[model samples]
Target: MADELDWQLCRSFLAVLDEGSLSGAARALGLTQPTIGRHIEALEQALATPLFVRSPQGLVPTEAALEIRPHAEAMRAAAASLRRAISGAEGGARGTVRLTASEVVGAEVLPPMLARLRERHPGISLELVLSNRTQDLLKRESDIAIRMIRPTQSALLSRKVGVTTLGLHAHRDYLARHGTPRSLDELDGHVLIGFDKESPSIQTLRAMGFQMGREAFALRTDSDLAQLALIRAGAGIGVCQVGVARREETLVHVLPEDFVYSLDLWVVMHENLQTSERMRLVYDHLATELKAYALTSRR
Candidate 1:
């Protein structure tokens, strides 16, 4: 096996790659530009190859950088994991756990779980990045990830938290005003609210004979919270997960048992973090909390 490279240098390389320039990376790391330069130089010397090429576009990574990116990321995650393990061994649950998830998971799923985590581990801090785009766990962009779709990356570990049930929902007042359509064919005249872009749930709804197209959205927002708020305000009718829609009494199931879809939720972490006490605690707690809503009955 190749001799282990300098971890500090690898970390600097990752920082440079993430920030897109040495100066930016230096600012992020709170180090001088010269120090950052030395780190990169040492890393290249140790590996005996050029990892990046400097250009007008900033530091462009070479093929070697691309090849070793995953390993370098694993090293950084492992280091964070080690810090958590050491802290726990010292009898303190401390360190930052970075988590990434979609807007729905961030707004509807993780808040309660985070509350419980705060109560249980007072010293642990959480950094949550909520976006529709998938954050790379293997690249150390996040310590843990909550995703609707199961991840297939070989270097990451994943567990199915539970499945979420989705159904057509509308405000009680909206249904009273517009009247509920009994058949999918009757949906033509009824205004529908849905995700703007292609999503699994949207595709599922389309497959189920719902007429969802560019003209379907009477109101649309990227944030699930915003969408739910609009639905609660009786802006339009749309599909929502049972767990999210059930929380609001004003939002009632439209199709009820006639139309429903299910999607699996997965809690994923880099394999390097499996032994990390902080990451483990957060991951396990989220999984347990999510499992409670797995097979919820529509109200």
Candidate 2:
């Protein structure tokens, strides 16, 4: 153990925690397996505790390791943010910007905009993290985020992009085969695609008379992308972003009058990064592009 904790040891610790083995961590960090093993052993000695217990499945994290993970992850995010900040100051718009958004938005919405951005400023690079789970800007988990909800955190700078309208949609082929439901109640007779587990948004919908129980869905998944894919695949009638559905000519809007839900979309970044020129460029670009994307469903 040394006077000050080494960050490399912590980085290796976090990698092993995520990947579940020394070899896996080594591959992720581009280090050799023996180096990763030594880092882990040093980290454990520094902390004065055993971090992992081996099993037939692989190295399983002990309770101490699990408790240390969030702090280690926070350190990783801070290190990345610090690097980006320094690079931004030195190179103008030539630095990496990490952005987070939901799966559907990351896949379907942002690629074209990002391609254009790259064409305009080839020096600027992007790292996109796609998940339904919200990344904490305060912790610097992501430099910027596209959020469905309002940013209530004190140190966040946010721009309301627009609203994303959600509605029932079905492939033309599926509708031709099964017939379109005239009302919300008629949905019971058709194959429905929806969330396997109730989320806060679904709970809100249910409170507002939307029927989205797990049992009601014939094709069940929590991934918004999966639900949208099922609708595109003619799997069944499912809830999808109206803007996205319009992109596919085969997808037909179903029960527009009966069901209309809007999720408020925002582009948010940490207040600390508001002064960074490169950060501002990406932040405003996202707000502009997403606002346009949100308007497509108005048709």
Candidate 3:
């Protein structure tokens, strides 16, 4: 085994990990499947370890693969930055900047900021990946991330973007039909829509003295949008961000004003791409936009 390895092989390995299959990686890289396979085979052979275990669902990465994923991602970001630097020198700062964020933020917050970026830098392309799951930034999964929770990894650079207030809310029609409860104890008699027990949001509610066990829920979903939709459909009461709830005429706050929770939002970037112009621009724009929601009066 040699310490020296081909950069292209590492790129292919990253593409496979991101796409979850050789065929997907081949399509993404615009290379033949056999070529992609050869790269992975060479990578495994060079490292003298199997990087992934084949599964019916897809290729599941082994421990060795997981260990090297962050490094491979760093290399990819470096390569992208190098390309951008050369291109910017020739034609000014211009290229695609990819961002990953939770669905709520993507839907409620990013549009205006992204519009501003397009207006200011039309040459820069933006890719927004919306999901509840946290993307692996070290793997170059996205150039930037807007997350609800602060990232624990030391390799990434993170900034507090803003904070959002959350509280129990119910549709006007539902509350009219079932009647609103005056206190937390009365919640047991009503149908509740809530996150799963493991969700941090639910845990926070629990800590705040809200009973959020499974027994209280008539409906539940992992997706923020799904939960909001159910709430809109008059399914039951559930917790929601004030920014989102404020926009809805039918949704009304259920609890007293003092009974609210706050969550700090963060804008994060891979250390490797911290100097990239497009990424920096997007990060700055998001930080500015989120400030509006941070103030208590805004909520």
Candidate 4:
């Protein structure tokens, strides 16, 4: 069984685990669904155990799949490290760097900064993966990640650049139409915009005395970019990052002193890629630019 196992089979297995379905895994791997299915079938045959079970939602990994995941992940990480090492050896800060960030930051904050980076390092090509879900750095899903929360993975290098504050805000027109809430209690009377699903930010707000449920939001969406767009469109009052809100002149901060939360910004990369000049350059550039951006919100 050990002799039959190979990186290709392991790669497909991990992709399915990460994506939760054959189609998703195929898309992630840039392979056909039938090919991905064959890989999974071959992997299961070699191991002589079922890797997944059919469920209404999607493929659910069996205990056997979960048990072997760590070892497979370690192999994937090792391969990535080897690639990074070789690329670094042949580099002059000229290589590809994959970066991941939340949708809002990627769309709103990063464009100008990334443009500047491109101007400075013409040799460095970048791949940006914008997502609300944190990319797995250890899995090499992304070479560098700009995350709002601190990472707990020991195998990654990280830096706490700064904190970006968030506060309730609404378009000027919305406030004019429906008076601004002066206090927390008044929020219930007004149409609120927020995440449809519970998240770390929502949980933190709950812990900080903003005891509200998903039902509280009149317009609920998990996408921060979409939430900001809704607020800008005068849909409702919603949470907006200070740095982001500052750019929109029509966005009025609501109960600024009352409703405020800060998210710590982090730039992270795999520990194995520390020597990769391209990765380091991109990481440092983000750290510097993001810190400057955070300062703008405070003022």
1 against 3, candidate with superior lDDT: 3
Candidate 1 vs candidate 4: the lDDT winner is: 4
Q: Which stretches of candidate 1 lie over 4 Å from their true place?
A: 1-92, 199-211, 297-299
lDDT for each residue of candidate 2 in 209-243, tens digit (9 for 90 to 100): 77567998999999999898898899999988888
| Global lDDT of each candidate | 0.80, 0.89, 0.81, 0.87
Residue 101 Cα positional deviation in candidate 2, in Å, after optimal superposition: 0.6
Best by lDDT: 2
lDDT (0-100) at residue 137 of candidate 4? 82
Clashing pairs in 4: none
Q: Give model 4's TM-score versus the native structure.
A: 0.81
Q: Please give the ranking of all candidate structures by lDDT, highest first, separated by commas.
A: 2, 4, 3, 1
Better of 2 and 3 by TM-score: 2
How does each model score on TM-score? 0.69, 0.95, 0.75, 0.81
lDDT of 1 by residue, 131-200 (tens): 8777777667788888877788999889997788777888989889999889776666677776667766
Worst 10 contiguous positions by lDDT, candidate 2: 203-212
Provide the RMSD of all predictions against the true structure, rounded to 1 decimal: 5.1, 1.7, 4.1, 3.4
